[model samples]
Target chain A: MAPKVEHEMHYRRLGRNVGLGLSLFAFVAIVFWLTLAKVQRGEPVEAFDHTARPSLETQDSGN
Target chain B: MSDASLQSNVTTPAGDAGFRDFVALLKPRVMSLVVFTALVGILVAPNPVHPFVAFTSILFIALGGGASGALNMWWDADIDRIMKRTQKRPIPAGKIAEGEALGFGIALSGISVVMLALAANIVAGLLLAFTIFFYVVIYTMWLKRWTPQNIVIGGAAGAFPPMIGWAVATGGVSIESILMFALTFMWTPPHFWALALFMNDDYTKAEVPMLTVTHGRKSTRKHILVYTLLLAPVALATSFTSIGGPIYFAVSLVLNLLFIRGAIKIWRRDEDEAQADKYLAERKFFKLSLYYLFLHFTALLLQSALGVTWGGF
Candidate 1:
């Protein structure tokens, strides 16, 4: 029987680097997706009611 | 040859820069200060940024900080190899190659600057780039190796983080940001000199002309006290700014007093007395010096929490 030939792989082409790249992409994608969803749903990731002054700001006498 | 030997030949020892080693290269404790002060800078700024972008900007700033650290390690590996405190660091310990450290630092520097520009603004990105250049090229490569004034000048690199943070928020510099920069800038000399006072031998052996080695411990002590005195007013005055409040002022006053006292103690100890117990006074002063910076920044946070509102930047 003829010996089998296994193709050589670059480190960048290997699972580790590819996994890392994909994971980073996934993380960014998820964040963007969630943010978009939040916007569409009218729920902000950070919602500050401008009319309702922050308690900290209101407590101060800034005049 | 066995597969193990083949793998070992292919994977050089230099390839052993582990995850922990890379993280250590970032100087995480210092990075924490960078992140916090930068966050304060962002939060206190007059112009609000999107939270996601703000978060990414801070991360890039931190990565830039880590890059600076890596470059410092790369440049100082020779001396680091000798110092007991830093002997086991990745570059010095043979875990990571020196060239690899340089490459990593350069890569991170580019990524951080570009990413920061994308995440925040050109002003912040420029500040980050300047910080990296100042820390690596100016401080680590040149000043640290050349003069006793190294700490005095090099301190500017570390001090700029708060200003950068402030700029990220306001898109420009302000008096308050300058004051924050001054506090750290002035504080750096004394804090580092105290450590250099106690660790004089390390620098001496490494042939690094730290103040303690070049000017003698007495002069170093006197300088420490003088800088501490100068730093006190600046620290105290920062509390009166829009960002500072009752809590910050109180904490700054107390911390400065304690820090000055420690410097005074170190200054007064005669050479014989200081050496009587292997520089115990100097050692204690050095420990207190670490908390000095932390306390001031913590006070700022406390003031913010205390319902004293100050617009950022």
Candidate 2:
């Protein structure tokens, strides 16, 4: 007898997955555009700190 | 036993495992927890991730959860079928077969890890892979049948998601993520023991040595109270970190106090009185434990929001 093979995710599952993918893509696109625009206009984005951490030498270490 | 017998022992069940059964094998409830904690990890991290990468990372993390579930289902289908609590699951129900579940789990496990590496970073991908292996091989295959500490150690598998989330965003681990992991790890014993206290027979019938089964119910109750006490401090402490503030601290204090109170109330009642009356207190405690973790995580997010906007702390 030939060996049996199985596929867990089917076509319907795939189609549903694709729809979800598109929706997620759209949501991400909107957020990215807004963030980029805000950064361009010199607004500090609450989501990220653009500040660079201070170098080791800049901090007073008790020698 | 002969070598052939040993080989047959493994392969017989492997042959019967199926597709939908495999999908069912992934513990969906556990997977949802992984997704939620991971999402919180990403959200609360000091570093922000790009949206595309962030979404992809979360998606793969969810899939990693699904993969772990599938693998667990694959290995435990036999016990699953025997236990009343798990018997109705797809594999146990025979709606799908074992080999199918094994294949599905393995395939998804690879896909999730690799895709996560591509979408996010190597650390997150490696962590996801480790999470799957730990759940399947260490917890399911080995620890569950052999020891009462199965859930205690196995609980680590569930605790990895938030850490994985932290890695995906920051490409590394941190004290904050470790605290998140610790909270879940400590929370597992009481949450599960409460269910086990109520469902002791399920573990007994399946020959799984749950703490209640091995140590006796009184001991289990004691352990629950002790763990609840330990958990209360950690839960409140996490609220003081950068991601937390007054809101989270207040909520954590109130929630942990109530949680400890609930555990103590259950502990005070004799097991028979607790169970003979259909385990009402234990049941209520179990439900409350679910809300406890959610309330804490939500409060952390709320604290972050409050800090950012109010008084700009």
Candidate 3:
């Protein structure tokens, strides 16, 4: 068989795939950093749980 | 399938779109201005943002701006194909499909708004959403072809970035934020009108109802001078606000004088004179207008960085 050769189109496709991957990775990193900063600033970080939490109880009572 | 046949099958019209074409769809040049003004908005706020939060918020804002750019390009692709200035854009150039551009815009719009809200605050997110809507729906879809004053009112979309940035930090609006918005809002008319004076053929060919096309170049020149006259006070008045300082005042005074001088030269000329000089005064005024806005914002950034104030206010 003839030696397989890489074409210019393959390189362009590779480049686009790499760019997309990097953008996604950067997005994840940004979200992680934002979450870390918010937590460090002592802003409340709440996720829905089936049970009641003290933080929500206090916020609701205050409101 | 054979490898050669597979390669040929994959080479469709839309298959040639590279990553850069997609970036081009985002209008990186316009996004840079959005990023810069939004950064200024964030930095000059009375309250400080966490560096990471600020960074993320600005990224999302730029994304939102880019999203709107994509949407604008998609909607305006028909006129874009007719305009000399826009003929080489991704859609008109056939590098990207129009449907692809629309989907890309909608996806980025949703992501940017939601992420900004999560990264900054609800106010910032809502402002971003409104800005996107104003640009895409109100400006591009509705006003752009309907009236000669399209750019006059449409400029509000571009002016909202700093306010959004201010909201990111302060979680609300204020006089300072409003002033920054006003500065851009007031400056946009002359900046675009100057371009219209030079690129009159583009608007004419595209039938976009630009002031120059509808009212004539002489009328456009008069409008430019009138708007520049109005712009000077707004630029100068920003200096007395909380964000303003001695440096900003000095910068604004000098720039406004040059701007008015250029506008006067433009207003005084007839088409015969302008044609002889290739619209030199108008082109020069256009170039100066870019620097005028950039330097004003830079001055505000300097005031914040140097911790200086005019002491009078």
Residues A1-63 of candidate 1 have per-residue lDDT tens digits of 111111122321254355547747965874575455446534232343544334334345673
Against the reference, the lDDT scores of all candidates come to 0.79, 0.79, 0.90
**What is candidate 3's lDDT per residue for B65-148, written digit by digit as tens?**
999999999999999999999999999987778998999999999999999999988999999999999999999999999999
Ranking by DockQ: 3, 1, 2
Maximum-TM-score candidate: 3
- Could you report the DockQ of all the candidates, in the order they appear? 0.06, 0.06, 0.32
| Model 1 regions more than 4 Å off | A1-63, B1-12, B309-313
DockQ of 3: 0.32
C-alpha RMSD of each candidate structure in angstroms = 7.7, 8.4, 4.2
Worst 10 residues of 2 chain B by lDDT: B9-18
User: What value does the lDDT take at residue A4 in candidate 2?
Assistant: 19
Q: lDDT per residue, candidate 2, B1-313, as tens digits?
A: 3433343323323334333344456676777787788988888888887766677788788888898787788788889978998888877775556777777788888988987886677999999999889988999999999999988899898889989998987889888888899999899999999999989999999889999899999999999999999999888778667776778878889989899999999889996798588999999999999999888888877766556432445
Q: Per-residue lDDT of B58-125 in model 1, one digit per residue for the tens? A: 88899899899999999999999888889978887765788888888898899888877755668989
State the displacement of the C-alpha of residue B101, model 2, in Å, after optimal TM-score superposition: 0.7
